[model samples]
Target: MPQPHGFRYEELADGAVVITHLERAAGTLRGPRAQQFLAEVVTGDPQLVMARWTGNYKRGNERTARNHPRNRH
Candidate 1:
């Protein structure tokens, strides 16, 4: 898969993390979960982290699944 792009995040004053994809709101992480995400994001790849957090990452089988006859509809 291509490298995940268009993912961004912002930290809020109340210890919340707002994640966005392609400039659109995707998810908000608060409290301990937000802290955990922030730690992981800085330590690793931001794009991958955001994609995973936002649940917008593409699985390897997407092309195969999309080409399948059952999915054409």
Candidate 2:
């Protein structure tokens, strides 16, 4: 069967079909840290993920501001 543009389909050994977005998949995480993060995402609630990311962004901005030399004046 022909796949649609930007999408690909694979049939697993167990006969399950997995359809993926080619563009999106290209940007996804790789390596052990990515695996650990994915495991958390798959097992935890979306709200927790949102909260964690929000806090991370907030702290990142704060760190940037703190390290800016102009802030000393």
Candidate 3:
């Protein structure tokens, strides 16, 4: 899969984190989650971290799973 890009985040006055992907709002993190995100974002790859946090990354199994017999409509 390709690398994740265009991910950004903002910390709100109420200590919530708004994570955006491709200029759209993807998720919000509050309380300790927000704090953890801030810490990890600084130390890790921001785009990858943001994608994972927002549940936006592909696990590379979509095609196989889609072709599975149980998943057929």
What RMSD does each model have against the real structure? 3.3, 13.4, 4.4
Error of model 1, residue 41, in angstroms: 0.4
> Please, what are the lDDT tens digits per residue for candidate 3 over residues 3-67?
89999999999999999988899999999999999999999999999999999997899899999
> Residue 58 of candidate 3: its Cα lDDT?
79
Name the runs in model 1 displaced over 4 angstroms: 60-73
Score residue 71 of candidate 1 by CA lDDT.
96
lDDT agreement of model 2 with the native: 0.43
TM-score order of candidates, top first: 1, 3, 2
Angstrom error at residue 50, model 3: 0.3
What does the lDDT read for residue 21 in candidate 3? 89
lDDT of 1 by residue, 1-73 (tens): 7889999999999999999898899999999999999999999999999998888878788889999999998
Model 1 RMSD vs true structure: 3.3
lDDT of each: 0.93, 0.43, 0.95
How do the residues 1-73 of candidate 2 rate in per-residue lDDT, one tens digit apiece? 1212343333455543333454343222345544554566558653344234223223336668877999866
TM-scores, one per candidate: 0.79, 0.29, 0.77
Winner by lDDT: 3
Once fitted onto the true fold, the runs of candidate 3 whose alpha carbons sit more than 4 angstroms away are 59-73
